[model samples]
Target: MPSSPLLPSRPSLLDDLAHAALARACSAFRQSGSESFALPPVLVDATLGNGHDAAFLLSCAPPEALLLGTDIQPRAVHAATERLAAARQERPDCRVQIFCRGHQELPQIWAELPPEERQRPLLAGVFNLGWLPGGDKSCLTRAESTLAALDFLLERLMPQGCLSVHCYTGNAGGPEEEQAVLRRAAALPPRRWRVAYCRDANREDSGGRAESLVLMERLPISRREMRVAGLCQA
Candidate 1:
């Protein structure tokens, strides 16, 4: 009998379990707002980049929910701004605020908006960490800065609103930053917040051999909260 070329020399049970757990976690959350809202809450794409996450979040929020996308790269800000502006045709009331600064500057940017818009409830924030596509590698999110941004998010996000961090391990500092953030996530007091992780089990995706999506929420004693916490490796 000819040996199969791809067969593993040993069992990979632990890897299989970890992968399945992560897959289940990503599927836990249902998409918000089936249609739209009259005055939606606020959203932040802390990494901005191409504004894909920001655009999607805006669409899912209430019709009037405003959005602010910030990135350290000027090109990213421009790209996100342009993308969001174009996406707004379908969501006119969805105001967009683009900032050319580090994600840590979110609080300052949020404060600078008009009183009425700034006062809107923040639904959830998104962070796609890594270099701006085709941009300088040095400008990607840092560990210290990311933690600081999460602190800001926790303070500003409305109850039950979440913060999603898409961590990339295949790039500079991405693995280290993900580790630092996860360590911080582990210590988050149960009374104040919950941590979640989603990873594909099969490593079948073309993106990479593995990837992880992290979502953090502030909620006390809820079914969702418990489920999220249970998914955390920390």
Candidate 2:
């Protein structure tokens, strides 16, 4: 995968893990077969900073996939849009949507999608939470907005689909946002969702605060649970 010029020369460890998770999710979704799942899997970059992650997703996603991205900063959006131009040209079959809006607005955006596009199974969603790298530090993602977006995505994530949240605890409001994310991850019912929280205990790279990654996968409901929920015949 090509690195975006807007990003630093060295990729962060959190980024490496998030990218790996996304790649595995995409690969797994492809191997799951269309007969058992929806065609053209849908993936989202919830925090599209410079289009680096979006580009990476485009490379790994199924040939006929929908890639949605959102960013709160116009400059970030512009940079990402520019960064993805080559990839989009290379992969004409992949549909890409880049929104210059906050992740919190995802519900409204999702509501506006065509019924067919809306019906496509969301296979994965990745969030790099904090502020845009090399952008305004004052404009940061808040816990309320992040949680709202997470709630919406979690409800729609397909079975075996995963959500990768990379939280940076270095900036203003970052700790609060990370704490909120941890709380939500902890609250998910284990029967329906598998969640993991990882952090470096010995390293404090970002202003003496360690970064964390929260990975959550949606588990398929058993037939008994489906019957209990009235989703299947008794």
Candidate 3:
């Protein structure tokens, strides 16, 4: 008899887990009652690799929302632009901004947005930290720039807004980048930030290729809630 297949040979569990994380981030915006906006909510797809994440993000975004996609490689930028264009043909209302800039330039681009746009709620920021699929494998995200970009983006997150990242630790230097991101997530204050991290249990100790997802939400802190926490501490 043939040996039983492991885990029933279902779809990619890690990918499913990451997708759920992104969905939760999108739902947070809906629950926060932040939908009243003069302009549609803004979203950032920081590393637009092959545009899969960007497409998913556009699906979850509010109508006419602005989606910014960034990548350092010309090929990636071109491919993502094409994918997003097809996505736009399907949903013609939404607007997209494609940039060949480094992901680290995200903060700068966001900073230059019109004051009114900045005032609007940011629904979500998604990142896939690795090289472009089917392209150069050596050009991976670095810890320093990735951490800096995360910090900059998180500081601007509207209440209930979240940042989600899929970190692929299968390639050279990828594990260290993921670890740095985890350290940053660990350091966020619980009172103001809610973070969720998920990794495949089967790959935890195998020292093999693995992917992890991290979601960080900036909590809406109220005066009453702060006082209650202070009283409890006292």
Candidate 4:
């Protein structure tokens, strides 16, 4: 008999879980209806390495949704640009914006967006942490910057919006970075955010150094309510 479509044919990997989280977020957003927003909602790929995540997000995001991507390396930006060119052509209604910048600068970049775009709800974001594959290993994400970026995104994420972070703990400083991310996620108020950490427990490779995936979703509550409850800033 053929494998059931509902069940996975193979064990789920970190990427599989991350994409599943994103897909769920997209589905929720669609159910919420686009009429809630004055403009289409936005999705972000914080680490647009090779554009694979960006492509996946674009495929799942609602029609005309704006997809923003960023990378510190010019080569990565170029590669993603090329990789996404066909998708852009195929979906002309959807807007694609690529930036050659670090994730740490996300706040400043967001501040510079037009008022209308800034007002659009942030539906989802993806962050694949650590060094870029097939690139210089010396240039990798750090805890300080990554935390700063997460702070900004969490503050702005729309209620019911989700963010997926895949942290590879096998790289230099990776263990420290993963711990910092987990601490931050755990610190979020339960009334306002839902956070989950997934990893392979039985894996013995790399002396128990396994890739970790953190999934976070903002609960359905008004910003005003959160502020009134002292859970968020005014």
Q: Rank the candidates by lDDT, best first.
A: 2, 4, 3, 1
lDDT at position 217, candidate 3: 81
Model 4 clash pairs are none
lDDT of each: 0.66, 0.84, 0.75, 0.84
lDDT, residue 102, candidate 1: 89
Q: How many clashing pairs in candidate 1?
A: 4
Q: Comparing candidate 2 with candidate 4, which one achieves the higher lDDT?
A: 2
Please list the residue runs of candidate 4 whose C-alpha ends up more than 4 Å from where it truly belongs after superposition.
1-12, 204-209, 222-234
Give every collision pair in model 3: none
For model 3, what is the C-alpha lDDT against the true structure? Answer: 0.75
Q: Could you give candidate 2's per-residue lDDT for residues 49-148 as a string of tens digits? A: 9888899899888768899999989999999999999989888989999999999999999998988888777888999888877889898889999999
Could you estimate the TM-score for every candidate?
0.71, 0.87, 0.82, 0.87
Model 3 lDDT per residue over 1-234, tens place: 889757743225655565566667666655544333334678888888888778878777766777888888889988888777778877677788888888788778878878866655576888888888789988878888898888878876765677887787886677888899999998999988888898866664235478888888878665465335331121
Error of 3 at 130 (Å): 1.4
Off by over 4 Å in 2: 1-9, 204-208, 220-234
lDDT for position 207 in model 4: 57
In candidate 4, what are the lDDT values of residues 1-234, reduced to their tens digit? 977659563324788888888888888777866655456778999998888889888988877889989899998999899989977877787898889999889888888888878777788999998877899889899999898888888888877789988987788888888899999999999988999998868654365358889999988887466455433334
Alpha-carbon error at 170 in model 3, in Å? 2.2
For model 3, give the 10-residue run with minimal summed lDDT.
225-234
